[model samples]
Target: MSRIKQVFKGNSQAIFNIKEIAKICKIHRNTARRYLEILTLKGFLYETQKGTNRIFRLKTRDLRRDSI
Candidate 1:
């Protein structure tokens, strides 16, 4: 999960789909999706639907905080 967070912290304003995150993190897509869902539930990320895809972005509140 920390690895996943690093991806978002690197580009706070960038939004990503599960596939992109999985590729970047070098994890299985399902694993990436689960981590994303956990972050979303924890209020660290925002999830939005783009057609059939679920996109995620770091929350602005999280960006202001040192700890995620």
Candidate 2:
């Protein structure tokens, strides 16, 4: 599985920084940032930027089912 997929699927309450992803996924932090940007664009994640850091969270699952 892609690193992004693994992270998002493994933990429901996972909110992670690019730094954490880099460390855990063994990818460059810039690559982590790109994963986040793509997930955010796809509506599977949300980004909260504070200063120079970013915190990402999964969008609520209920929201996904409600659209059906």
Best by TM-score: 1
Assess each prediction's global lDDT (C-alpha) against the native: 0.84, 0.75
lDDT tens digits, residue span 6-67, model 1: 88888988989999999999999999989988888878888777556989887774565756
Task: Put down candidate 2 lDDT per residue, 1-68, tens digits, no spaces.
Answer: 27766776677687888899778888898998897788788787888666588888887664334321
Which candidate leads in lDDT? Answer: 1
Residue pairs clashing in model 2 are none
Compared to the true structure, candidate 2 yields what TM-score? 0.78
- Cα lDDT for residue 52, candidate 2: 87
Q: Candidate 2: give its CA RMSD in angstroms.
A: 3.9
